[model samples]
Target: MSRSILDEAHIHPAVRSIVANNHANVIAEVKAAIASNPIVVVGMAQNPFPRKARRVLDDIKATYVYLEYGSYLSGWRPRTALKMWTGWPTFPMIFVNGILIGGANDLQRLIASGELSGLVAA
Candidate 1:
């Protein structure tokens, strides 16, 4: 269940700090949202999946928070920071009760199976 990460001993000492703190502000923002909100969606602009995810949530009348980063044209560095942080390769990284439940299609499956309703009050 966990992905492999470089051990501290294997990484050069000089770059450890840089690796740890790269785009830390963005991470902090998402972390803060996760801590405070029962459901959080980390997404990027101009991505249809994120929009679809939002629409689905809207249909259920779920209370959630959404954080959007860059689009196809710009702001990718921050998005990369998120990808590295979560190890989830795509956008619309939906979190419920601070647990990442995967993206839009995943959300649809959860909804269809009636699993997501157990996590968040709709």
Candidate 2:
């Protein structure tokens, strides 16, 4: 089988087991969403970045799916493993066309440069 960046060698064993049971469908679900929608955002509610990112997307009328997990999940630990899995160290990990598009700041930069609109429209 092909290996992804989230390969077992890179992730902690506990994180892997947590993902296997609790978040096994995350990557697949995000992939399917991004396939049909152009943008997919995974983040936590307590983090201001994700909310801000949502507002920005709303302002631009961008089609996207925001998956907020941190606070909503009991004890809010899976997001940590997810963070390790994605290798992104913050909330609001945005994806455009199935590609990691960084966080709110990156999105703002793209919006400022007019690339965000082009990406969402495409």
Candidate 3:
């Protein structure tokens, strides 16, 4: 399926600025997070269309895990792992460092505000 119209995967100016301003720190933080927790980003597949979200994850160099309840039932379902975001019904759910980062829109907003880099740094 095609990507959703609401998919704002483009890197915002604030994100670019944050990266440019704190490149070394951001990279070090991200590396540390991934090194500490191999599964830093989990991408749940709530919808059939997930290109945009996947692209965003790829751009950020985050590991993407597709969790489609219908496709397969495993010992650890993505929903079960991320029990906090019960309000949202779709997939492409992003989790950074074990924290719920919302869906595509939320990610875009975070990037736009430069909070994504801060979160990574934190």
Q: Relative to the true structure, how large is the alpha-carbon lDDT of every model?
A: 0.92, 0.77, 0.52
What's model 2's TM-score? 0.72
Would you give me the overall lDDT of model 3? Answer: 0.52
| Order of quality (lDDT) | 1, 2, 3
Per-residue lDDT of model 2, residues 7-116, tens digit only: 66887886777656665466566557778768888887677889999999899887788877757555266676566556778888898876788999999999999887
Q: Which model, 1 or 2, shows the larger TM-score?
A: 1
Off by over 4 Å in 1: none
**Model 2 lDDT-worst window of ten:** 1-10
Candidate 3 lDDT over 26-51, as tens digits, reads 33443455456523443433443355
Give TM-scores for every candidate, taking all chains together and pairing residue i with residue i. Answer: 0.95, 0.72, 0.45
What ranges in model 3 sit over 4 Å off? Answer: 1-49, 63-66, 71-85
- What does candidate 1's lDDT look like per residue over 2-112, in tens digits? 898788899899999999999999999999999999989988889999999999999989888999998988889999999888999999899998899999999999999
Q: Where does candidate 2 clash, by residue pair?
A: none
Can you give the lDDT of residue 12 in candidate 3? Answer: 73
Q: How far does residue 51 in candidate 2 sit from its true spot (Å)? A: 0.7
Clashes per model (N, Cα, C within 3 A): 0, 0, 2
TM-score of 1: 0.95
Please report the candidate that would top TM-score against the real structure. 1
